[model samples]
Target chain A: MASNSDQQSMDVNYIARLARMNLDALEARQFQTQMDGIVDYVRQLSELDVEGVEPTAHAAPIQNVFREDLAQPGLTQEQALANAPAQSGGQFIVPKIVE
Target chain B: MSAARYEAVIGLEVHVQLKTRSKMFCGCATSFGAEPNTNVCPVCLGYPGTMPVMNREAIRLTVLSGLMLGCRINPRSKFDRKSYFYPDMPKNYQITQYDQPLCLGGGVEIEGASGLATVPLTRIHLEEDVAKNMHFATCSGVDFNRAGSPLMEIVSEPAMHTPEQAVAYLQGLKQTLMYAGVSDCNLEEGNMRCDVNVSLRPVGATALGTKAELKNLNSFKSVLLALRAEIGRQEQLLREGGRVVQETRRWDVEAGATFLMRTKEDAHDYRYFPEPDLMPVVLSEQQIAEWARGLPETPRQRRARFASEYSLPEYDARVLAADKAVGDYFEAAARGSKAPKIVSNWVMTEMLRRLGETGQEIAAVQITPAALAELVELTEAGAINSNTARELFGELFANGGSPRALVEARGLAQVSDSGALQALVDQAIRENAKSAEDFRGGKAVALKFLTGQVMRLSRGKANPQLAAQLLEERLKK
Candidate 1:
């Protein structure tokens, strides 16, 4: 993000935490170098803006694609929980959720 | 530094579950209480290559609600992906509208204040609701039946100063949405949920204070209690030279206070970005107008109209128009009736009382408005005394039938004919000579006792007005 400096720094630990990953210091430092390169390229692209171009949300210029409100048959209980690592009483089970 | 000098500033974020037939993006049925994961599909479960398509009815219904609330429709709005990590949503993010929401700048009219006032709205956006998590001994089970159901969030500005005003705002929105047939708005059934932000500032201060967000206020009573407690807590802390922290709190109904849930998170943490999978939603004026057509008048408008049209008192109009079904029933029974005030009294007292005691819905009650009107007319015409009409009312209320047919079949009509009344008047004079003689002896109160005798002699069908007049005339001689 410090585009003016000759060398940029990236906080890989912060990014890894947001992505729900646990990494060692060595791996974090290595990933930080790779992330710095990615950010430098993005900083270069950010310098050339026309100031009048509209921001596009999607690549295709389409709108208002909708389906009717009729219900369609979805998966059965067996099919829905088929790939769960843990299951009980026909439901997918995870570790106890607390507030 | 006085506690009484501090005023509470409050705002609410309300979420209402739309009564749609299918999910917001996928075709899974949105039925509540279904078995766990039965409504799951790859599109809602966030599987690869599964994209979302909008549901037309959900969009139309949300727009209709916006129109009823007097919001401006945006011509172009797009979806944004709000990044978060939660087990309820499989994609680790939620598809919502951040900057470009669908409707903007509406107000809800609340009258529980000194007079009618409008609480200004920030915006209303449509999104998908998450799944339900039920905890067991060591695990939490996921039920995808509620996932991807259409949910509408209405955000209000920090315009409320008291808890009652916030509740009035919620009730106002509930009535309008229910009248529009967009939702049931049943709070106990989890159809409507609310979160409130509260802060306190000194009286006559222009600046705001740090706010705490309160959740799990399931009912209006709890909202009132929790807010009062939280306001007291903040005032005490401020008086003791302590600072209020910005945090999220959960209401404990049993404890009568709010406990800290978490320290507040910054908005930047969500990292919202435009959704790449969804195209921008562009609506035309023609489409907005078409959606607005045939929308019912809001509850506020209906309350005002009922006061003028039916010549009812403000109290009657307020109570009647609060519920859609009760308002419709009143209009049907009161239309073209000579005594609308009388009709209003009966509805507010007898009909509502019976409905409450019997625990029956107004729709399921066997009494038709036309039948009820006939009973009122019969009493007004003196064809049957009010006492006899009330007896017939009980039967008609329990079982549907014509009041006229029931009265005719039971021979319950009053003896208004002079010849038939003369016989009963003479029999009353013969049976109760003491009351007749006392009436003749200049005791005007004796005529009421004589009339009772005539009513008893006529088997409770004697018109009290005619009987009193006859007794007075006969005793004068």
Candidate 2:
């Protein structure tokens, strides 16, 4: 599934910024080559002539899965904030955001 | 500067909370005004490894709304995750329809300045509501009670040109959703919220200008005012040789001005991906047809039918059919009465006035439709006069009672008996001999004066027509 050597290069730093993550220069360079290899491997599927095939969103053939509208009891205030790293006055506290 | 030289292009995105018992993906009560964070569950709280199950009722209601708005319900639809970083959204990504929406291409007919105009709709999609963020002085609080609630986003095309048309379009949409029983559409409770997009262009221009999105327009009035302020701001900028930047503005309701919130560059790139937990919704033609057939008559259809079936004027039908409760009350009363116009008059003038004064809903009125019908019938039968009916309506509105029973108990029955009214008439003629002589002398005003005296003597119970007849008969002698 290896791609030709002349394929377009991937920009890992740009993609990392979009995902709101920071990566050093060395890591970005290493991830760029690895991501290129993964993309090339996945691109091999384009060789097949499956023109009439339907695009599937899920792997399993399932539809119309739903739940009833009846309400059940949920978490209390204490339990809801149990996993919070910081808390104040029965609320989860985080860094202040000003806009 | 001539305001007429510029045309405003406007579109609206409305979010209506579906009236479901539970949240969209979990078994948590969707009731508003509950204690903060009480409705939070594992799935809604975005806890790791918790999967969401679609609420069937929410999907049904979304389809119901789509049908009411005349939208084409996509037979195959699926959900996608819209990624964003907002504190109110517990998941940091809202599960909504992106490329494939549930409904597409509908129009709402509004009474525009020129006449009836149809506001074209772009799409209607289903999404999960986020938690409410309440800002305070020192810190902000979050209420997860509204989190994960079912919300439908109805996006309109840039068809509205004026603030008035936008308001009309919103009102028409609200009426249709309410009639469909899919949502309460209460703005005060935050069940319905709007986002407006406004742009300006030269009059008769072919291309559209850059648009600024308006936020925090909770009420219809705010939507109108915000659009007006934004349009003015844009026009002023253009006239000053400055360009209008595409940004989001917040409407300062108190200051009556719009302030810049964020620019297009700051817009979040909602990296969307198909939701894997929930299965795709594949509806059959038979199912869609069945749902469409079972839908109630839309507000517009009801308005038209009210005009033709009840023989009411367009104005009367419009006002009556604007609200479902009012329309139902009018129909119930009209069905009982022979004269539908009489019923319309009572409802439009008297009933609506009382409703406004007491701040009562039509369904909560003390006077039932049957009672009102009975009152109208009594007035038409000459059992009670118009003045007496008005008084009775006031009493009935204050305290519930049957019009017939009240009339009988209060002794308000009109005195149509010639014997009783003739006695009263003879006494009035004797007491007002000068006026009787004046009447015989061909002064028509004197006859009215004599009848006033007879009515006063009879305690207003005298049948006016019979009293006039008896007075003329006595005058001839």
Candidate 3:
């Protein structure tokens, strides 16, 4: 379902706003070109001869992944906080979470 | 609207995090509420040159979910890599089940008129959860704590036709998972999240209409409200001869409405392929059956057993079995000391009220079922009057002491000694003469007030019924 070229740009910008992505002028112009390319690629995929081809959603060939329910030692606070950029009062601290 | 005027169709995808001790594909702990990213390792963090070793328990839990949901377990299933780029997704590709899922063609039974109605389950597959994304003004932060977590995604057929039916299906699914001990099913903690697919058609339409996907419904109540709002929006479009576009929407609980997010065409391509790092999983039927045998009694079966074995009312059985801890509490209390019905009363009324007031799940309760059973037994045996039992229950919850011990230590037990109660009743009659005369004249409430006075004289320990009888005999003379 392709829309008019001029109208599609407006819609895309609106969607970018809804997703809270602030695309600058240069990024918007680049995205317009990229969007057209992606639209063409998907259109080509739709044209492939597939009268009865089952759609594949996954690519991995693995099954039966699980773990036993047993008690195990967990990471200590010091070890857990080793990678943090900041820590305080035995808790990881970032900028205040909310106003 | 009348049933003949509209047709409603619904399908649900429920994501459940398995309650295993370790991650799905690694030995990293699966526990939640740890310091952020503490449990992560190279495998889970998607570090280069590291390969994932499939956890056997993750597979077992997936097959078990399929069995409990009434699905056909695929002896052979494969994991695929779903390609995506996001800050929370460090690898840019997630290991998941795609074409060949672990369980296919399964269904769960929901309560229907007369009995249980089996809802056809389309598929139950295994997947990995993404990391948490915290948005800032200029940038976004990522937490790898949830990344690589084991998730089972269950898809149901578009068979549910009403909001109530959708909620019931969700409840049933949660119950089955909890009963199998596969998950804790805590919605608030994001252990259970649901996405609903809803479509509307004409009253007699043979084929389904365009469907919209709604996401981020954190609670069961929100699911119902979101679906209802979507259904209403779709009906309005149809009645006005407008087209209903197939798209993904997000429910804003604060606004109480659904907002269009994006169309299907703009959706991510995913670029799914066989994960190069992991191997295909194969399970034996005997192996699956063993896991199935170990499953705890599912909520549906437990509800039926509670009704027939304990002779509990249908509503009581439903409420008691709503959660595993609540059901266990009822069973422990009813088994040895008090009758089932009496335990049900205190639990349904006082215990439930207190739990709700404190906003605590039965699992977090300090009062054990054994303690509650003793409390019920004390009240039923008249060892303590109803008021004293109520007071003692408050103390038991607050102090974490045994019900019997608290009653004994506080001297709150009923005074069954007839001589002691009658003397207090006599003292009460002598204290009030005109009110005693009025009791002889025919107002029965006056004697009730006098019984209260005698209870006060005994410091709230006198047997109320015996005190009332003694007061009536003395006033009649």
Candidate 4:
């Protein structure tokens, strides 16, 4: 796959627009060069074909993972709100939620 | 209009939140009243480096729920990732059962009003709940409290031909889950939610007509009403020769209309793939046996038992078994009182009425099952007259007092003494001489008047039957 690089050219701005992203002219021209190189590098990964191999989606080999219906200790009010940027009494204070 | 020629095809997908102590795939607590997000952990929050380990309680509950619904348990099952884009979704993908569900090919039996029928269940799968999203005008807020909760999604085949069957099927399913101790099944608290697929076709068409996905029906009444309104909407379109569009719609309870939400997009494919993070869920035969043996009799079986045990009418049995609290109370009282119909009557008429008046569930009632049994005993032994019993019932319901104590403390017990009642009967007959003469002249209604006078003389404490008997005896003299 890496040897057969036909050097196909495409418009980067067109792809960005389709993805609902706005890019300036200078940024588009610069990204066009960078993305083409990245795509070319990823194309090399196709050469190692293991057609029957399964795609791994997660890390753990464990299945049917579950916990019993037993209550456990939970965070205390002090610990729960320890990292809050703003706190009032026992609650984390935020902007008004209701209209 | 010419005899309408249309058929209503209905299918239901019910989501029941399983009563588990922890999240489906994490150790976060699955409690409702916990502070928002307090029960959450790194796994439920979808932290980048964290991985999920399924909760055993969730699996056991799922299998227990499947067996309760008469579904065949799948020996081999696995989880999949259903990808979607929503702010409420912490991982932008949900771990759910696909291809191989926990149970399949099961059904429920729901009785039609005029006859009996059965609804076929398509499948029951286990899944994790998404966080709750509250969309505001300018921004959206997400509550992670509900995230990672264990949810069992049961889909029914589109076998129902009428809206009434649909509602019955839903109610039966709710009661069944409740009996299994798998869920509270509270619609008000969002423990159970429904999405209905409805379509209307020509009278004899073999193929299904276009379907509209009705979303988020909050209550059972709303489910029935939404289905009815949707049926009308589809039939009118078909009659006008207009093709109904395949789309999703929201049921506007206030407007009583199904408004178009969105057209069916490229089939959500969800790009579902087996979750590699989890392993295959294999249940041992011994494990299943234990669960099955410990399983209590379902609502349907218990309903039949109640019918035979109490010799109650089918309607009364249904009302009694509608809620687990009421059904358990009825059984408890029946064992102590040995009068099923008598207990059923009190529960249905007096107990249910008080529950309604207070806007509380039967479990919320202050009166204990023992108190209820005692109350029935008092009534059966003629310790309290029927009228006095009704008045005492209110006191017991309001203040939660013992029936015997209330009767004695208030002097509300019936005066069954023949001497005392006979004296009152004589006084009534002498005071109402015209009524006495009318009774002798074959005016049968005059006896009822004398009976009423005797009751008034005893201040509603007189045994009504004894008063009537003694009054008739005095009139004859």
Q: Kindly indicate the candidate among 1 and 3 with the higher DockQ.
A: 1
Q: Judged by lDDT, which candidate is best?
A: 2
TM-score list, all predictions: 0.89, 0.90, 0.78, 0.85
Model 1 regions more than 4 Å off: A1-10, B265-268, B304-316, B334-342, B357-359, B391-402, B405-411, B418-460
**Cα TM-score of candidate 2:** 0.90
**lDDT (Cα, tens digit) per residue for candidate 4, span B289-378:** 988998978887888988887899998888888777889988887877766788889899999988888888777677777888888888
Q: Which ten residues in a row have the lowest lDDT in candidate 3 chain B?
A: B135-144
B1-477: candidate 1 lDDT, tens digit per residue:
655488899999999999999999999999888878888899888777889999999988888889999999988998888888777888888888889999998999888648889999999999999887888988898877888999999999999999899988888888889888999887877889999999999889979999999999888888889899999999998888788999989999999999998885632367688888888889999999887777888887888999999899999998899878888888898896887777777778778988999978776789888888888888888889978987887888888799999989989999888789988899889988988888878898888888988999888898889888887787777
Candidate 2 at B474: error in angstroms? Answer: 4.6
Candidate 3 lDDT over residue span A2-98, tens digit each: 2333342335575465455899988888887887777777677767798886543335533444446443454555665577676554344455333
The alpha-carbon deviation from the true structure for residue A11 of candidate 1, after best TM-score superposition, in angstroms, is 3.7
lDDT digits (tens) for residues B252-311 of candidate 3 = 999999999888877765657776666667778788888878877878788899899889
Deviating ranges (above 4 Å) for candidate 4:
A1-99, B1-4, B308-315
Clashes of each: 0, 0, 26, 9
Candidate lDDT values, in order: 0.86, 0.89, 0.80, 0.82
Clashing pairs in model 2, backbone N/Cα/C closer than 3 A: none
Residue pairs of candidate 4 with colliding backbone atoms: A63-B279, A65-B54, A65-B55, A66-B54, A66-B55, A66-B56, A67-B55, A67-B56, A67-B57
Candidates, DockQ: 0.56, 0.42, 0.15, 0.22
Best by TM-score: 2
- TM-score of chain B in each prediction: 0.88, 0.93, 0.88, 0.95
